[model samples]
Target: MELQFFLPMIPPTCTHQEKQVSVVTGKPVFYDPPQIKAARSKLTAMLAKHRPERPIKGKGVRLIVKWLFPKGRHQDGEYRITKPDTDNLQKLLKDCMTEVGFWKDDAQVCSEISEKFWAAIPGIWIRVEEI
Candidate 1:
């Protein structure tokens, strides 16, 4: 079976490359940034409402994520085609997917394809399938 969905919101600026933290009791504390946390919450809520009856389970799965960003200086219909970096953006989304139980584990998603673009309409589009 294949799973597909769209997260229709202005994609947050959060990237997994962002570090979360502070310190207490001689130990380093970690947490999501306020913005990142909010974004995760939004993604989680959306996923929970639509997630499969059971998580996708298998030895190999494929994941594709296409992120559409609000047009910058780019002309209409043109891709963002630059940095913020697609890899960085995928990290946060993948982690959120794991947290929302889209699958047994993100690691189970053996193949991944990610991308970003500039568009008049902005949101995230995701697809998953067993391989």
Candidate 2:
């Protein structure tokens, strides 16, 4: 089975973990930044709406993600081959998909193809399928 979806928003890169001394516990704690939490929440909600009625489960699943960024220095339809790299953009998305039951778990996704491009329309497109 294969599932495809488009999310209409500029995807944010994974937020780095921040360590701070807890006021109550007096111990260092790691937490997601408020902005990152909000972004992940939005992404999660978007994925949840598009998730398959029943989650997919199997060995060797493949994931494809295409990110379209609004034109800035790059022209419309240009391949965004530079920064705001793929892995960073993928981290939150894959995690969100896993949370929303896109698959039994992200570990089952054995193959991945992710790309970014400059487009007049900005959005993220994703596909999950059994291989």
Best by TM-score: 1
lDDT of 2 by residue, 1-54 (tens): 888888899767544333233545676656677777887899988888998887
Q: How far off is residue 6 in model 2, in Å?
A: 1.1
Candidate 1: stretches off by over 4 Å: none
Poorest lDDT segment (10 consecutive residues) of candidate 2:
14-23
lDDT of 1 by residue, 5-71 (tens): 8878888777777777788988998877778778778888776766777888766789998888888
* Per-candidate TM-score against the hidden true structure: 0.89, 0.85
54 in model 2: Cα distance from truth in Å? 1.8
Candidate 2: give the clashing pairs. none
Candidate 2 runs further than 4 Å off: 14-27
Cα-based lDDT for every prediction: 0.80, 0.81
Clash pairs, candidate 1, are: 80-118
